[model samples]
Target chain A: MKKINFYILLFVALLSVLGAGCINEQTEDVASNGESGENEVTGTETQIDTIYQFSVIDALLEGVYDGEITCGELKENGDFGLGTFDNLDGEMLELDGVIYQVKADGNVYEVQDTETSPFAAVTFFETDIQDSIKTEMNSQELAAFIEDMLPSQNLMYAVKVTGNFSYMKTRSVAAQEKPYPRLVDVTKDQSVFEFNDTEGTIVGYWMPEFVNGINVPGYHLHFITTDRTAGGHILDYTISSGTIEIDSCDSFYLELPENENYQSTGLSADNEADLEEAEN
Target chain B: MKKINFYILLFVALLSVLGAGCINEQTEDVASNGESGENEVTGTETQIDTIYQFSVIDALLEGVYDGEITCGELKENGDFGLGTFDNLDGEMLELDGVIYQVKADGNVYEVQDTETSPFAAVTFFETDIQDSIKTEMNSQELAAFIEDMLPSQNLMYAVKVTGNFSYMKTRSVAAQEKPYPRLVDVTKDQSVFEFNDTEGTIVGYWMPEFVNGINVPGYHLHFITTDRTAGGHILDYTISSGTIEIDSCDSFYLELPENENYQSTGLSADNEADLEEAEN
Candidate 1:
């Protein structure tokens, strides 16, 4: 009876040791993930998903970013989509009636079943980083680059010719409506650039220029707006217009152009008559 | 007595007619002003001490702009001081220990002290068309123009190495302690690009092969920032440094070089560590 008991105890002890060892091995195996696990690595596992956050030094340093976004959740086979400035591309990516294509970079993956959460993004940069944060850019580093890239008025010119001349000019507004757009140059005609539906308020000038390698002076008119659009499209808003005029020297000839909507007022150049009326 | 009285009356009537003509000329001149007394053909007066507000826009139509400020009095032939971001001969121009350069092609004026208010600050492209409501860019246009001139990131890559190989990779943070600095690739230990302390940020990247005519990898670095310069200095604070590491089989080993400041941390082969930490 004693010998039998010893054998049973020994057998139980051996099984317990094996069980503990197996559990440790399983934990270590799971922890050894190339991207998310806690295990130590033995070889290169570049084909994996990782998460990284970037640090932004300046609060005012915000603008458009160019990158990619994957599925909302993790899945096998590494299927995902991509996003660029005005468009998204991938395998059957259709958002709001717009189709997108994939980036073909092989580092993106897709999430299954969930629709509200769009995509799960990833990167392989040795230092884990996200598109918004890990741009491989620092504050000072970005500022320097921006300084060099700044647009200056040095490449443009301003000219004025008044006192009885009817020459042509061009007005060029941005493809999208941008508020406080740079007023480059204006036309020689009496046309005015109007703002949003605010009648009798001319805010810009109409200048002409060439298009498609052809000199189409005054063919294209431009105005400045504070609106934007990815694909160039005109907005459904009211606009003000300005016109040119020539007045006689004797009359109080204010060059207020005639407008069908806004009545044009006339003035006489008679100085004494105007002064007498003011005094009375 | 009757004949003399008749002659006097005729003389008085003729004098009145001539005076009326002169008065009419003055009245016409004022009317030609388009009821905009401040709208002179020369230029709008801008106050040097005035403050302007600004903002950024980045939809399809992207821009930055300054809002509004009172125009300062103008002086003829003023000896105005140099402004910021002014370029001299394609390089940033320096005057009185200040860099002054504008990107647009327009007339540059030196403020003179002869007039009542010779001092003047800058405005942006104008679009307002309400008579003398000249669309000289309020603050918004100026802000947008400056913002547009900044640089952007085109491409980025992640770097990783496997095994226990030791190597050295050194590059220059050329815009040290500057507002927005640029990074340059250095093969041989030599400063290919000079530094600008006042601008104190990495402004651009000087590729080794293209800039120095050397056969090297496209080890190009691009950096950009939007933080404005304060008191003519580039940087407002310091940023932390980065680290380097290597990948083993299923585990990642932190690699630390002798006397190196970077902190090397271990990463898993599947990136499971990073994933879990993010959730927490």
Candidate 2:
């Protein structure tokens, strides 16, 4: 009986040590993951949904036009997007996993993998809603119509309109040297191009008012023709008929530049008025 | 010689197996942590800075006053902050790791640990800048002064002011029942209080315009006396003397509720005007 009791006590001590070790391991795992341990025990993988952004509109407004990411790196994040190349070289349009630069000379050049962008918004195109419009409408009317069609005003939307346009007016800014002026100043000298009965796709995003400083608050579209010959930032377009595709983006991930220019730039001035002036 | 060669080959094979095992272990560690192997090699621990928010202000404005998190859970995130209790019970003041409820009954109660908040912003208090204010100034002047004192407009700031107030005016919303009206409507019946020669601390945050819909655009402050007696959402104050502390926050993390009320709410309306009307 004495031997049995002693053995039982020894077993209990060993069990307690093992239990404490398990608890310690569990605690460390929870602390490292910053989450409860239930998921770990079940081996559940947490899905992180994110909408990747290259740069902010505020930095662009502050005249930090230097590109920090190459076109090759940008393609890894999204196949469809819009922005300008380094030093405002041209209006950038990405569609079908290909990037095109519409220069001020009214010509579309396939962007080289080595090329870079100052500011851009891109995403793997996935449509949640699709509709066709047969009525003729201009840019402003189409913007209003899209706003009306949106399921929720609080969420951001990626927009794609593809079809033939009766009239398309677009503009592209010339590349600038160092000491770039504010976007509003550079945009004043933009070269405009007018195309008649053009077949192309319009790619852009509709941002909410809350993200105004971070991104354009309304429709920001860029046009790229089917023949890959001519395109630019869409200023005004009369769509004869088109199919509209909308993707409601619930996740947002903004990547800020790590360059010295972005670090030293002064972004305090309220750029709302300036942004509106430049965008229009 | 033949035996030596066999032994040498066996040793090399063993070393290769060990090296491959180490590599496999390292790969698994990196995959589990969801970080690159390069960061692991540098032995640098990434500090994830987050601003744990309660429910959104839009839901509050829309009259969704249900509390999703308890003060105890909130205390786990930060010790300094301000907000309102469930059903707009009263003003919530969190200071020095304790939460106080200043209700319409004109009494301050140390809130029970189970008490919850509908909306609040809190951070572990860490001051980056400290200064004294000698000049007497009203609420607007103090706001401007603090704005001028901020090191950067792009970053968020946690502010704390402690001293004597020549005059302070505050308001607290009464607890509401179900079928709650909009915040603008509830503000019409708020209980306002005025104090003279009060000594206390003011706590709040200065948010950027980019977070307009996510949070209050500017300052959102609440006051609590040093004696743990009286406080509410600060409407106006005439500061006689005070010491100000500001913490510049470079990282922001927002946590949204997963409740049915939040999931189905209509938040697209331009609530800026309504927010301004209700806040002032």
Candidate 3:
């Protein structure tokens, strides 16, 4: 009888330990999830081939230059993208997981992860199609050539062109102060940079007409030299030879800025004419 | 010794059972979440004020009539909004978590969970503002009043107007056969319905200009009678007494359709004029 009682006590003790093990497993599982919540990744990772955009082109055109999303947050979403820094400072281009800022002085610098952007579009760069330029082509002809190669023009494409350019004309905006002028006005005073016989890469998006208000509708490319030193919003580039890769983005995630300026600004007015002038 | 031996076997059996229970818990967690991959919910339960749209309006305008999102899938996203069914069969409206289809026969039917949609927009309805229309107002007057009351036209809104209308004019298109006709052509021969002094709700989205290509730039609404027996896409309505509730949607999730028809469709064509003609 004494032996049976001792065995029974041992059995109860072992059962509790096993039950405790199960409880700890669940607790650890939940704790790990809670930790990830602090990061951009949730229980599931963000989907690939999706273009994540912060704010709208219309808002930026109207000079809503301060945004909430940090450069760090945007980098987590995509390794490639293009946009403008806070205060309409300069042209921002992300390539190969690095964010480069072309300041108003026409010099390129590494963008700090803590810096914020007013407008930007980014996607994981996965080349769905590739074309090599065997001959020379100007901006229009190159654009037309790239356009013809897309599987469908209805979808947005992240375009990357790497090669030699005989001429590259670019512009970067100066950081603005208070009482910000319209984007078109700022572009008028933008610092222009010209490059000849340069080896660089052009990265941007080929957006559809529907994105006219949300983003620039056509090719909005920015060039970065091989050394990652300098580039700006591409005005025109005469390519002697290049290789173009396009990533077809099927999904779009647009997060509107919650700033008071974004809410109070007049975004309904037809800004197409102004947008065309400013982007060029 | 025999009793001790018996106790050891029981303890081992019980321990393995508990271990299996924990293993099953983890397995079930992932299995349940994804077994229904067709109804995969995004990481955030979809933001309250975000407008979730499947496919683009230009695709529909160009006769991409079939889609892949089931009615059940859309319901998981939002309980309020509007859209059309696959094959352009009829107008679809969701209110109070129920999907109602206003068919070409001028009859409202509960949409099946299995029914797919080609184009639709939905949002979890949470009214940020409410206004009472005590006096009579025509369609144009009502629209203008709502426009003036909006804080900013930059954001989208899910509008719900429940009231008595002196005159209501609505239309619904029949499901097209193979080789679907352009939306403009379908609307030319659409079935029209008129009601005198009807009690119902006008449910739809008031999108910003930026959504011109992806969604209707302005108001796109559907009507369902109080009895849930009849209604269609709202053409015109004269409100005698009504209460308007608007939920401002700040984020947008656009999921492009992957159907062969959608892939083959030419979505880049400017269908703004045709959209205006068909919608009105």
Highest-scoring model, lDDT: 3
Chain B TM-score of model 1, please?
A: 0.14
Q: List the residue pairs that clash in candidate 2.
A: none
Off by over 4 Å in 1: A1-68, A72-280, B1-153, B156-261, B264-280
lDDT of 3 by residue, B161-187 (tens): 999999999999999987999899999
> What is the C-alpha RMSD, rounded to one decimal, of candidate 2?
15.9
lDDT of 3 by residue, A86-172 (tens): 898899998776788999898889977899898988876766568899899999999988887766656788999999999999999
- Share of reference contacts kept by candidate 1: 0.00
Q: Write the per-residue lDDT of candidate 1 for residues B104-211, one digit (tens) a residue.
A: 222222222221111121211121111111223322342233223222111111111111111111122111221211111111222222122222111111111111
lDDT of 2 at B157: 76
Computed on C-alpha atoms, the DockQ of candidate 1 is 0.01
Ranking by TM-score: 3, 2, 1
Report the lDDT tens digits of candidate 2 across residue range A135-166.
99988888877776665555567888999899
Question: Considering every candidate listed, which one attains the maximal DockQ?
Answer: 3
Clash count per candidate: 136, 0, 0
> Which 10 residues in a row give candidate 2 chain A its minimum summed lDDT?
A40-49
Interface RMSD, in order shown: 39.3, 17.6, 19.6
Off by over 4 Å in 3: A1-46, B1-46, B268-270
- Number of the top TM-score candidate: 3
